[model samples]
Target: MARLFGTDGVRGEANTAITAELALDLAVAAAHVLGEAGEFAGHRPVAVVGTDGRASGEFLSAAVVAGLASAGVDVLDAGVLPTPAVAFLTADLGADLGVVLSASHNPMPDNGIKFFARGGHKLPDDVEDAIEARMREPWTRPTGAGVGRVRRLEDGGERYVTHLLDVLPHRLDGLHVVVDAANGASSVVSPEAFRRAGARVEVIGASPDGLNINDGVGSTHLEPLRDAVLAHGADLGIAHDGDADRCLAVDHRGEVVDGDQILSVLALALRERGDLRGDTVVATVMSNLGMLRAMDEQGVTVRQTGVGDRYVLEDMLAGGYALGGEQSGHVILLDHATTGDGVLTGLMLAARVAQTGRPLAELAGVMTRLPQVLVNVRGVDKDAVETHERVQADLAAAVDELGSEGRVLLRKSGTEPIVRVMVEAVDQERAQAVADRLADSVRTHLSLTG
Candidate 1:
């Protein structure tokens, strides 16, 4: 699992684990894997390539484009765009595969590469495994005219914006909105889309120096957006991370609205508009218990998955559901996108406000979120923590103590040797106390002392 890809893609500090040479090798490998699988039809399979606004992306993109083009796959180079835009273009342009050079919300020095299969869907787990396995075997490269060619496409952004506007239900006239681009990929296009949708838009963190992305701004930290919204007396504010695949909102009053709130509001809105397929929402286990209560009241059933967006997307596709998301702002509105889409999510959320003529804060009030506290306990046998008897007993005892008001979860870190003890309760202190007790229990029983 740690070989070529991470939770998102092949990520590493620039020029370290990730390099021009490595990027080229990966692109060539991907072409063989995607092409050999019959991804291309009659014509040579084409690929859409794009990247976020990281300084490291310039070389990475060039390397990736060179690798793909030299491998007999035509390249549609859509430079400096959101990840979802690449996904949309792949599906919209009828390409065979799309490659996005981004580490998502990772830091400035860190970068990665991710791929979308035909129809703009993330590669399946088995496909990912196959690619990793193929990395070790000898690879073939085409020669001369048999090799693929790369072409620059200028209308990539315009075409994506047009598609977004076409899907919108209403214009955003009379709406004054502040957008925080996190100095990442959405710096240009996000503001453009909002303006075209008719919102009077003010931009913050839109000027990316390539090194400042997600620095004191973006969805990971929402204070900047909150201030901009209140300072400008804007109708609302939206924040996007490095890759611009997820969004978090700040209301007119400078109050922050998270993914759970957004999902609740959008679910009801979609239900009213007859667009919420199957009257269901797919969410990860990390979703607030408050969301469950809200859905229960609205008679909307929720199917829960693990924490990753890929897991949520997989569940949505399997269930044929139209909506899914994580608590961290990753959302998948499958009717409009096959993956988590910040632009699409922001568009739909803003459109709800526009069409309803209500404050986004009020519309987001469909649920009262319970206070959740997560304590990560390091220096423990994380894998054993889940099966340890004392830890299990502590979890069961905590649940029995809180009953309907609260519950406890002990989740092992996938990449690190740590245990995350989470507790949700009616109040903050209680949740923190329960989480502390669980962490202590895990340390006592699974501290690797043996």
Candidate 2:
């Protein structure tokens, strides 16, 4: 059978690729696997479940709750919370498992199920595979009182916000910030958290009718946030995705500050305060060469990992690094979270601005982002990109042409049959031209239909 879980989780179109039945079955299987694996041997297994503001999440969360409860695992339903909030609550409440119903930055018609093990860490691949294999297996069903119970977690959001505030290195006093919650999970809590942290907060994209989440707002689409920040004359803008696990920002001048700049600023701030662990930052290969150069010049080391936040987290845990993230803004401050927390990233950025009395653009000046272009060629044999003679030759030529001044990367999509061609240079035109050539090469040599 095909794997249900992708790099992130079991994400797909709601009521189609992902359905209530699948959610229920996954929950039951997760409970059984976690129980048999000794997570619940001494006590009744407990799970903390949450979802984004997608309409599908309503039924999906209910299905997950029913499945876990039927399997004798008590459920704490944290409704309409961010993914990281669910993770945090799971660990804070000492639950055996955590589940979040969200497709993250995906549009409203899609949804997903993400599982976290004890300690609120994302489950390893082996554990996820075990859960999948256990599905449809026969097992004795619990009856009456032996079945688990479910309850609403009334203080879940408050607890999460409190945790965020408690971990801040500096407060956001005197800062006027705009927050775009993507009309999803972070709508209520994000604004409240900022206000509590002392920022004069203006909110946009906070209204959710369920179907409109991520429509034209959020981190993925920064135009709304940039315009909002400019119109409101705010010091900065923070944009979170559907589930708020990651964030990207816009400066006062309406320039989008991406993950590379964010990571660089935080790393420098931590280093200055003598809090940087090992003076190292872990990042994915997608991180810009300029960020790496900045870290190098600052006498800090950069550890590169694969594309996913999980891969970045694994490296951080292995090396005891204090910071890591992707270019897409999934940042993990190891001291604060086991996974990425968009709100936390935003707070740290804003606090840094307030502390230095520097504009966000100045703080982000810690790294100069290289002109980068990415071209995605779909309907291709992604596997062939690695070995196709023409594609490899084209990539090598691009690299040779750019030499030390630029970089080129061709990566295969883990979940889809697509090849991503990326090029970075000192000039935007060169980057785009190189990316187009590589993409054309990939299309020619690796066309799936051919």
Candidate 3:
């Protein structure tokens, strides 16, 4: 069977691939695995649990709570909070584990379960594997007083907001900001955070009836945020995913400011304050080449990782780097958060605008985003993308043709029989042309049907 966990966690359409039974089983396995690893040694174990406002999450959260409690782990049920809030509460309350019931930016029918270990850190692959292995294994059940207890953590959101405020470098007093919460978990806390930080906040996509998340809003959809920012004549806008673990923004002119630009701005700000460790920021291989160039010119180094933010976080933790994120706006400020916090990222971006007396557009202008085109070619032998002679030959020719002025990357999809052909150039036309040529080559050479 395939691994249950994806790059983030176990995710699927609710009630089907990710059912209440699976959530319960995974929670029990996780508790057992952690306990066996001595995470709960010398004391009773505790877990912090939260959920995005998904209807399916209502039952899944209950199942998870039941599983953990049955395993003799105390549960602090933080109802309807962002994933980052759960992580923060896990650490703040000295819990041994944290569980977040969310599928992040996925459509409303999809949901997932992700866990955090002690100190609010994402579990390493080995630990996740161990938990998966232990699932469905027969084990003795706790009874009587040995069964754990569950308590409602009514102040989770307030605690998280206070933490965000305390770490803010500067207040957003004079800024007019628009916040789009994706009608998900951040609906309340995101706007509240910006307001308390002193920005005049206007909100859209904040009304969650549990079925509207990621429905034409959030980071994946930028049109709503752009329209709102322009309509409000705001200094800028912030957009968060379903669980609010990722943040993307819009500038005053309704131009989308992506993660690369956000990272460049924050990198400079942190460098000036001597907070950028080793003067390096961690980014994925998918980051725009323009960002790399800008960092190089500014005397800051960028360490590249695989496509996932987890890989970026791994590199940051290993090198002790203070900043890292993906192009999707999953910015991780190591000094302040163990994982990506959309609310924190947005507040910090606004703070930079407030402090520098520069518009977000001006600050983001530190880098010029090269036009990038990606073509996903399916019905191919994705595993042979690298070894196939014709594909490699075509890729080489494209690279040689672009030389120092461009880049080409061919990556196979992890979950599907598709190969992604990505090309970046100084101009959109050239980028698209190169990408198309490579994708055609991949389809012709690696076609399984052929």
Task: Give lDDT per model, in order.
Answer: 0.88, 0.93, 0.94
Off by over 4 Å in 1: 1-4, 378-385, 388-390, 413-418, 441-450
- lDDT (Cα, tens digit) per residue for candidate 1, span 188-301: 889999999999999998999888988889998899899889899999999999999999999999988999899998899889989888899999888899999999999998
TM-score versus the correct structure, for each prediction? 0.94, 0.97, 0.96
Worst 10 residues of 2 by lDDT: 413-422
Model 1 TM-score is 0.94
Ranking, lDDT, top scorer first: 3, 2, 1
Q: Count the backbone clashes (under 3 Å) in each candidate.
A: 1, 0, 0
* Candidate 3 regions with alpha-carbon error over 4 angstroms: 378-390, 413-418, 444-450
User: What tens digits encode model 3's per-residue C-alpha lDDT throughout 1-450?
Assistant: 667887788888999999999999999999999999999999999999999999999999999999999999999999999999998988999999999999998899999999999999899999999999999999999999999999999999999999999999999999999999999999999999999999999999999998999999999999999998998899999999999999999999999999999999999999999999999999988899999999999999999998777888899999999999989899999999999889999999999999999999999999999999989898988878889888899999999999999999999855345788889999999999999999999888898889
Which whole-number lDDT from 0 to 100 does residue 386 have in model 2? 84
Cα shift from native, residue 105, model 1 (Å): 1.5
Q: Which of the numbered candidates is closest to the native, going by highest lDDT?
A: 3
Local lDDT at 100 for model 2: 97
lDDT comparing candidate 1 with the true structure = 0.88
Tell me the TM-score of model 2.
Answer: 0.97
Per-residue lDDT, model 1, residue 102, is 87
TM-score of 3: 0.96
